[model samples]
Target: MTEPQCPLHEGAPRNHVLEDQCIRKGPRRGMIVASSKIYKDGSAEVKDRLKDGFAFEKRSCMHCVDPGCVSVCPVTAMRRDPKTGIVTHHPDACIGCRNCTFGCPYNVPQYDFNNTWGGIKKCQMCNQPGVERIDKGLITGCAEACPTGATLFGTRTALLEEARRRMKLQPGDVYKYPMGDVSKPDRWHEKAVPVYHKHIWGEKEAGGTNVMHIGAIPAELLGMPPLGERSAASISETVQHSIYSYMALPAVALAGLSIVIQRNRSQQDDNEGGQS
Candidate 1:
């Protein structure tokens, strides 16, 4: 008898993991298409879903309401845009301290160690000039590339509502899943929903994130670790603010100490002169 072959080894030509299996399910008003056969891959070929499909697990930046990178950037290189609430980085102002690296819990920031003039690189949510998809009322590159609606882009409130709705779904129930950016649904995938873990990954982690995720497997299995409510950045900022609340406090203390020392020195000089 022939030995059983591993499902992964069968090389199933990359299973369709997107919610919609139909080729004609995009905003193009034609066949659903992917620009490339392999969107992304892992070290091992068979370990996870091949490039054409979505995985059971999803992870994204825990866009902490209180972010650590924002606190640690000395030159104000990292900032949260008030309009979108997306974390933006300014390479021009960056002094390359790498303080943000130590502060980030998600480890999303990447360093450009290869460059002679080293700098940092991270997901700017496609907000840079010319690549401004979100600004133009479009989707981010990752969200656009994702056929499964896994990586969604939307307002924090809307995304949170969508995630909550998904959690309420019973397994095997048909649901309409939005794809390629929630703000503008250029594409859509419809299918029977997979059973999801009760908890939303970024709902409350480190005081919440704008980008959210829902998955069948636990977050830890998807490379996300369990975290506490207090974000590292929040803690650092609290300590910093407490110590430097007012300039007047330090100034007054210094002035009083200086006056005492000067008076003592004058008295000592007079006593020495009289004795001489």
Candidate 2:
């Protein structure tokens, strides 16, 4: 038992424990893609911020339906799990070309160019390297560890519903929201509800994403990528397929080669006559 004046609540959550390495481990090892904050007092607040005053943004992968990260990888190092649709990187297959980093519109991929043994990095959403938290019927580390029900995991369908429902709620109203997976919530976090920030990230940007987001910060601050309904994969596929579909590109190449050969032969014949 503590003193009467001492206020004791539940425990605070730890974000992706592995994520700290990305944020603060070393120049070569650490690369922070996500961040969080706490207001000293519930009364203190920032404009366009979550009303409850706690703010965090995990700038992880958009997990695009047609991800460039997967398409641009020459060695097939990056791939999307067909069953779960999680985009993941396979280190063994990687040739370290860094095409994925350049191809992605969201700038989600990370490269450890500082080390002698460099590697590509990104949040696999706990689905990589056989972690399979989703397949094992569990949730992501950030989602499970989030005490305020801030980070959550679930199908795109359920998450969108929860996000839309929150937007309709009255701000400042105390509400008990589900934590972890929305379908089978692990726990609850009750707080004075904050006003919706007006966007549910990863919904349709780049043709939608598996892991979604909703928070106070608008456009730039959220590190949200500007994308349209169509994914980069679709556009690339369309162009490549159209060019090759009729074998027209091959005809063009053959024509160019024939012209070069004819010019070479004509020059050689002229040179022989001059020598004679």
Candidate 3:
């Protein structure tokens, strides 16, 4: 069977084993869009200083603290781990409503259109059954296989600390960047730091995300959506709870249905008597 290929994969710089181990062979069949731009300059300083360069922005599920996907999933198909806070999807429980797709601000969850029996597909942090990398105490495939230590895996707390450290560094200063796992890295790659943006992408964005990002350029330039600190999910939940408190909406609907049925029955009896 011909698998659906990512249309955006061709022009962008390919990450090692991201397509092979995490995408095609794994449970996920969704496209992880990576926005990129090519740069060229004719100025003497630009020609002498830098070679052909490209800027890339890779985004997966933000896995929000107050996830809209989990909130909107009526069947509880999309759930967040209480301890780990990882948002996961249960295919068996899925009704194929595609509610989660619309709920997510990052547009992470997607339907597998090419499959015979299509389902929702997104990164579950490789913790799903038969491919439980996180449960097995191993890092994700993308993190494990990244040659340049571009991707690192760890607890949210540790990552935030690391991100803060990076933000404080001078542009040309050499720093020992960890590879693979953040807490217990396989090795350190020392390199001169580049300029960094002051903001952390996911921090306080729609009530924060477990998967945060810190980069050189502004996140908006890299296709990250602008969001408020207050979560959309939390706001919606508050409104829904107030309206449906004490089963008021359901009771009102039931009462309306009963009245309609009673009126219909009365009209039928009158018509029957008139006909006789």
Best by TM-score: 3
What C-alpha lDDT does candidate 3 achieve relative to the native structure? 0.71
**154-200: candidate 1 lDDT, tens digit per residue:** 88888888888888988788888888657568778888777676888
- Please give the lDDT score for candidate 1: 0.62
lDDT of 2 at 198: 79
Clashing pairs in 1: 23-32
CA lDDT, candidate 2, residue 213: 74
Using Cα atoms with residue i matched to residue i, what is each candidate's TM-score against the true structure?
A: 0.72, 0.73, 0.73
Candidate 2 lDDT, 60-149, residue by residue in tens: 567888899898888889999887888988889988898998888876677766658887777677666556666778777667767767
Q: Whose TM-score is higher: candidate 1's or candidate 3's? A: 3
lDDT of 1 at 146: 65
lDDT score for residue 198 of model 1: 80
Q: If the candidates were sorted by their TM-score against the true structure, best first, what order would they fall in?
A: 3, 2, 1
